[model samples]
Target: MKRAEQVTFGGGGLDRAAHLRGDRGALATAWADPAAAVLLVWQGKPLSTRSGRGSSPDQLVMIRPDHPLAASHRENCIFLGLAPTGAPQFACDISSWQPDALDQAMLASFADASEQQHPDLPTGQVFTELRRMMAFLTPLEAELAATANAVLSWHKSHQFCACCGQPSQVAQAGWQRNCAACNTSHFPRTDPVVIMLITHGDQVLLGRSPGWPVGMYSLLAGFVEPGETLEAAVRREVLEEAGVKVGAVTYLSSQPWPFPMSLMFGCAGIALGRELTIDHSEIEDALWISRADMMTVFAGDHPGIRPTRKGSIAHFLLQNWLADTLD
Candidate 1:
């Protein structure tokens, strides 16, 4: 838990400048500040100024946004301003148009050629003209990238009014949608997921889903359905997948996984049974592993069990669990 924030997309304490959003004079002042910079996001990757194939070394990203309109431009990208901390600045992903393409000249600092030229960068029909360059941006950059993807995805999926079957208009500076016909208001949504570590004594549970890379194994996770509590969701998912009963579920930590927006609730729970009647429909295979074997997986020495993906909560939790430091 000490390095919880070190996890990929953990967080950077940006000011978010929320106080200025509603006020014209104040918002204009912050927007005009030279130190107040915008974090640039293209596709889902942060636009890093640093030179690296991956991993932005610092979280400070600065791009000043110029809306040039009296009122907010609906569906325009959001530029969260951050006041400088001792080190880099902080940022919050506030506004953006519905899921847009990753193309052409974006409005941030110049990105390297590797990002502008990558094959994955061509999906954007709108800003696809931005050059491709490869570099590792800091957390601020990652946050902005997540912002673009989440907002755009929301907009793409939510064009119609939920109440009146009429098309809606962007409002609230890209954070809200309004039905012109029915006067209904809509907001961006984030889904919830529970990623659990089921342990008996020395061993823990692991499973693999269909079509995943060979030997890749991690904690069992699933969404929290409406009307279900986090604890209930965990028990349900565990039973449904590996046929193991759970007891004494407790909250541990949370991470923002913005692959289309999800909150991963890391948890530790006790497995009541060792027998794994895997529902082949839910998991390819499920079983218990001793701590000794877990060490092998972490070391990449396991013949069949693969380690958790880097930057994932599963990896974070498993690393701590093995070290006896989940406390």
Candidate 2:
């Protein structure tokens, strides 16, 4: 758990100038500066680039202020944090743009970014889903993408005020939304979810949701309910979905899972009993997976099971458990 932040998207030291976000003059200066760079996002995907031949190392597609797409959506540009070295960064959503067929094809290719082409930007750039390319991205790239997707998605969905039935305006460099009708302010929200690595003896509890692909199972997870502690949430979720009692829940690590903004609280727990009584409504199936069988699943040799995808907190926790590194 101590080394948990060392996971992907975990160790980036980006300086998020929270205090300066409310200053209009400072944000304008940063936006107009030549050194300021923007990451393009379209429909929750970030623009990434790859070099010739092989796609071993991929980079985020960063554009200058004067780029054609930089100002395409005047209201969609949100100020992301500054880089470690003090370069200003922003995320611009171009989801409204209509790309041609070729651009669409390039955007869909998760692997081999070398062959992608974008008509709206320079060569060697294509917008792809962050979840697909997260493992290939650097720590900084992962953090930026996660932040951008979460904040932008919030803006897109929360255009109205919850206090009053009036529309809200974005403020604080896209960090806050204010409604004039009721004088109410709203901040970006991150729903807390508890994903547990529950163990009984040598086996761990894994479950599959109803809509997940066949053979895909992950650590049991559920949203934290109102006024509930994280530890309590972990125990409640495991029991609710898998009908297994949990004891001594320990916090493992945290991840910014920005698929519409959620903070994943990774935890490890001890299952009080191993009897399987799955709630078919919450999870399609639940079973205990031995450490040996999990090894095969992670190794791509399992005949009927595939481990959780890389770059997810579930995968991170399971991998550490296998190596006996969950300290």
Candidate 3:
């Protein structure tokens, strides 16, 4: 657990500059700085530029506010924070532009392609999905992309105040929404999810959601409901989904899963009994796999089952567990 934050999207030591968020003048000065940079996003994807040579490196595509593309879309710009170097950083959503015929054709090549180009910028700049490019990005880049996507997604869904059903306007450096009619203020939300590594002796439990890709399984997981503790959520979820009682849950690590904002609480729990009466409504299948077979799954040598996705907290825990290094 010592290297827990080393997980993808977990270790961006960003200076959020939260104290300056409420200062309109400070926010203005940050963005106006010549060194300020913005990460462009379209839909949920962040813009990235790659060297044409396959051996070369890929990087996040950043531009100044004065850049043509950054200037093109000002309505949805968000102040992310100051970079490690103390330069201002921001995210701009350009989801509204339409691509040309050539760009449209280029977009078909990747699952989430960056076919649309600013007339002033080079051709390789494309908005690509974070999942596909996560491994290629640095910790800071991943954090910026995740934060932008999560906060922007929240704004898109929470245009109206929940308290009084009145329209809300962006405030506090894009961190809050204020409603004039109801005097209600709302902040960005991050749901807590408990992803448990349940063990009984040398075996671990894995489950497949109803519509997951064939052969794909991960640690059993669920949201922490209102008024529930993280430990309680783990026990309740395991019991509810697989009908397997758990005891002595221990915190492992955490990951920021920004598919619309979730903080995955990784934990290990002891299984009191082995019987599994799977709740079909919660999961498609659940089973216990021995440690030896888990080794094969991680190596991609298993006969039928695919391991959990790399860079995930479940994969992180299982890898350390295999190495006897889960400290």
Clash counts for all predictions: 31, 0, 2
14-91: candidate 2 lDDT, tens digit per residue = 789997798888888888877899988877778887532375666788888778878765455788879988888999
> lDDT tens digits, residues 1-327, model 1?
455665555574555555544455655565555555544444444434433335533232343344222123322544343534512222233224334453444434233233333232223212221113211334645554555556656776899998998999865445678898989999888899999989999989998888676777889999999999999999999999999999999887887776667888888899997998899998898878999999998999899888876667898889889999887
TM-score each candidate.
Answer: 0.76, 0.92, 0.91
User: Which residues of candidate 1, in runs, are more than 4 Å off?
Assistant: 1-6, 49-75, 79-144
Candidate 3 lDDT, 137-207, residue by residue in tens: 78998889889989988988999999989899988878999999989999999999999999999999999
Tell me how far the alpha carbon of residue 176 in candidate 1 is from the true structure, in angstroms, after superposition. Answer: 1.6
lDDT for 270 (candidate 2): 99
lDDT of 1: 0.65
Question: What's the distance in Å from true for residue 325, model 3?
Answer: 1.9
- Model number with the top TM-score: 2
How high is the CA lDDT of each candidate model? 0.65, 0.84, 0.84
Sort order, TM-score high to low: 2, 3, 1
lDDT of 3: 0.84
| RMSD after Cα superposition, model 1 | 6.9
